[model samples]
Target: MKLLQIDSSITAPNSVSRVITAAVVERLRQTHPGLQVIERDIIGAALDHITPVNFPSSHPISALAGDAPEFAAGRATSDAILDEFLAADIVVIGAPMYNFGVPSQLKAWIDRVIVPGKTFSYGPEGVKGLIPGKRVIIAISRGNLYGSDQPTAALEHVETYLRSVFSFVGITNLQFIVAEGVQLGPDARQAALDKALQETSVLKAA
Candidate 1:
């Protein structure tokens, strides 16, 4: 089984999402022996925002002969990112809420994967997702509470956005392990982390 582990946290060792994701991956590895794992740290290798030069419409027909060096490089990077996502049977994402949304680095990665003809398509039936049957697990951390009953629930965008995007690409087997209110206090942080870690321990294996 192929597993793609994507980390988008800028906090590294101090990141709650990162710690939860690591525990989840380790659990999966234990359950699925010899699983092939590919790790990508978006914060470590930041991707540029999509531009006209690297956008799919601007891809050159042959060898990118007429394309600028930077443009060609950008296109290649985008293609590589998309290819990795396509090749994975399972994907585990470490996403922390940033200003009530996902980090720009993760969004940049999403831009490459959610291609029109590659991952999805539009038809008379409306829209159709090309990629299906892949399992996705997201580890999410939030500084404040945003549960359905919370006053800030409407401001919760990370999980909502991720669900929409993944479902759009035909991935319905989605799981989320969330740690919220980590910044509330030391006690609250540890409690949240403990709960999230417990969830990771019971994750279904590939």
Candidate 2:
């Protein structure tokens, strides 16, 4: 299986989300000895925001390609990102909630992957999902405790937003390992990390 691991956290060795993400990959490698892993670090690469990925390069009807050089360049980057997403069997992402939402770098990566015809298409019935078989696992870290059970759960947008994007593309198999309340105290942070690491280690074999 080809696994794509995306890490967005700027903080490296000390990041809880990165720690969990590594553990998840380790678990997958343990289960499947031949797993091929591809790592994309969003912040590290300094990915740009998306513009136009819907336009085809070889359209027979128009000279749009010659008219827009910017679109051509933008499409190249988008295509590379989309290609990776399409090729992966399992996707592992490090998502750190910043101000109740996903980091801008991660959002930028998400934008580049959502092509109109490639990932999804609008039809008479509804929006159709083109890619539906990949499994997505997210390692999410939050400064405050905000999950389905926390007081500020409603304000949490990182996981919810990612779910919507992946679901829209028909990839609904999602799992999350969360380390919450990291900023509360050192003990709370360590405890959350421990729990998330445990969860990552016990990830189901399939």
Candidate 3:
């Protein structure tokens, strides 16, 4: 089995999402012996944001017109990113909320993977996802409380956006292990981390 681990936390060693993702991966590894793990740190990679030149719609035109050097490089990076996601049986993402949304680096990675005709398609009835049966586990960290009962729940975009995106691409076997209110205080942070770690410990093997 292949597992693709994507970490986008800029905080690295101190990142709560990173910690949770690592624990989740470790737990999975313990259960699934010989699992091949592929790691991608978007912060370290510095993936470029999507642009007109690198967009899929322009790829054919660029090829016909002789792709610019920069465009060619960008296309290759995007293709490789997409290929990695496609090849993985399980995907684990470390997503730390930035301003209540996903990190820009993670968003850039999402842009590369949500390619039409590759991950999804439009049918006569409506839009349909092409990639199904892949397991996706997201480790989310937020400084503020954003549970459904919390006053700030309306502002929680990290999990909401990811759930929509993955579902759009036909991934139904998705799960999230969240650590929220980390900035409330040291005690709160520890409590949240402990809770999330416990959740990871019980995660079903990929």
Indicate whether candidate 1 or candidate 2 has the larger TM-score.
1
User: What are the lDDT scores of the predictions, listed in order?
Assistant: 0.90, 0.84, 0.90
- Between candidates 2 and 3, name the one with more favorable lDDT: 3
Candidate 1 segments exceeding 4 Å error: 56-66
RMSD of model 3, in Å? 1.9
Least accurate 10 contiguous residues by lDDT in model 3: 56-65
Is 1 or 2 the stronger prediction by lDDT? 1
What are the runs in model 3 whose C-alpha is more than 4 Å off?
56-66
Q: For model 2, what is the C-alpha lDDT against the true structure? A: 0.84
**Residues forming the 10-long window of minimal summed lDDT in candidate 1:** 56-65
Error of 3 at 196 (Å): 0.5
After aligning candidate 1 to the native by TM-score, how far in Å is the CA of 85 from where it should be? 0.3
Clashes of each: 0, 0, 0
lDDT of 3 by residue, 70-113 (tens): 67777777788888999999999999999989999999999888
Error of 3 at 189 (Å): 0.5
